[model samples]
Target: MGEELKLLGAWANPFSRRVEIALKIKGVEYEYLDGDIIHNKSALLLEYNPVHKKMPVLVHNGKPIAESLMILEYIDETWKDNPILPRDPYKRAMARFWAKFLDEKCVPALWKYCWSLGEEQENAYEEACGVLKILEGELEDKKFFGGNNLGFVDITANSVGLWIVVIQEAGGFNILTPDKFPRLCKWAEEFRSCPVVKENLPPRDRLYALFKARFEKISGSKDAELASRH
Candidate 1:
């Protein structure tokens, strides 16, 4: 057993899940504390992540680490068993490339596709597919992004599927329909079947109801505000 590891996370966030999945893969014992950084965050969150003031701060041995990718590296380094990073130097670099790619480039268009409601939404919808096309190409012949068994890239890439499903519902489009991205769709099924991920996931139907309610609430507010102008 090691010193206590605590994670401050938002349930719906893929950024947070990146760290969570790494922790689970490492078999490190940790306590997860959920928060709504959108409103009031925990005192520990503020103290631990004074700089970023963000959720998904990983506190290990009372020291805090921020940023999902950085925290993952820290976890990998701290725990020798069940390493998340591939041993090969080139593969490690490629893994980080994909992780950063997800953090930077992939998320924005995905968000816009789910939330935008015009030509802008249409453009972002296309952009999201373009990004998925790149990913599908990368995964074409690979078992996982690290090539054999699960590694950092596999976890990070699949974390985005949470967003993909949510976006599919929000945008009224099935961007990841099994027929279109068979590999990805199959990967999603297998990934979720993993005990750590499958057990940790919020119940799908319950999550759907919560997301639907929030989506309708926000959209209704926007409609009401727009109508008041006329």
Candidate 2:
């Protein structure tokens, strides 16, 4: 008999979506438990990830794994039919490096740029574009970040390829225009059109609405805080 697999995730979270895509690509059957990480988290989520208390925790046969990237690796390793990482040691290392880079550098910069205002937002936007240029250079002639396949780096960059469009649309920004970064822009379109990716992605209109509401809430809170200080 197969082991019980359950994924604790939030619908709008790109990190959680990454795991969902990986599972789909691997053809792994698992139960998805949508958690309200923003408002009220479930006891299972707290129990699984007490330290970080974050979503995208994978529960397999009663054992829990936290962090989306780690969960991706775990899923890849546990179900080796459709391997996500390269077989060559050096190539595998490179893939892991790029994935970590996307998580630490690109994701944070994009998030900050979207949420912040004035000078902070400008700085973050510049930083994100600079990083994206580096990624574009890395892409060079490759179809995806992991060559032809939607491998580790491609999966990790879903935030840039998929979610960023909704974020830009909702926030009324143009950070990922064709004129500025043609290669990245093209890559984004191609990435989203992939069979696995396209099938798993959240609806653009729905994502835009969700982000719009969140952005308003954040801006309203900032306005309230500023008003209180006066």
Candidate 3:
């Protein structure tokens, strides 16, 4: 064998899903270690990503790469068969730009949804919507951000949708209502419905229970709905 490839990730993370999707699209076989670091982090996580110590660390041939975006580029370059990003220098740079926008602007709100219910929570919700709205504008007549197919930006931006329903229920907020953002709503539907992504999604009930419990902990008896579960 050439070398063993491994991925350390948590189930609910969109960041982690980026790496997972890239691997699948590339047809790269790898071992997945899904242990949430929010509660219990694995030694592999610490050893692989010492600095930020975040999840979705890809270990290739014993060398580790931290940060999901970096890993996305590495995956694209390493396995060039099913191209995710554009080949042209300018187009590739543009894809990176949009990916950066999604990573920075939209990803955090999903995690922060729970434990926030006041003005701060409200602001977070709006900003999150605003981020998606920007993308909607950019995708005016395009099927995918990559133009014809699901490209790097599509996978990266769509990662956050994994826990959207859970985050909404846990945080007691709704930003991407099916009625409000039709384009985005449709895009989310298409994104998840895709074979590669649909295959790897976590169970809804499991994520709901997990997020609800975590939400209860953070807000501390503030959420009446979760209290009903008790």
Could you give the candidate ranking by lDDT, starting with the highest? Answer: 2, 3, 1
Can you write out model 3's per-residue Cα lDDT over 60-165, one digit (the tens) per residue? 9999998989999999999889989899999999999988888777666544543466777766666677776787788776777778688899888755555775
Model 2 compared with the native: what TM-score?
Answer: 0.94
Clashes of each: 0, 0, 0
For every candidate, C-alpha RMSD to the true structure in Å: 1.9, 1.5, 3.8
> Which model scores highest in TM-score?
2
In lDDT terms, which candidate is top? 2
CA lDDT of every candidate: 0.77, 0.89, 0.79
Cα-based lDDT at residue 128, candidate 2? 81
User: Residue-wise lDDT of candidate 2 within 74-181, one digit each (tens)?
Assistant: 998999989989989999999999999998988888888888876789878778888888888999988888788889899899999988878988988888888987
In candidate 3, residue 219 scores what lDDT?
Answer: 72
Candidate 2 root-mean-square deviation in Å: 1.5
Model 1 residue runs over 4 Å out of place are none
Q: Which ten residues in a row have the lowest lDDT in candidate 3?
A: 106-115
TM per candidate comes to: 0.91, 0.94, 0.88
lDDT of 3 at 48: 87
Better of 1 and 3 by lDDT: 3
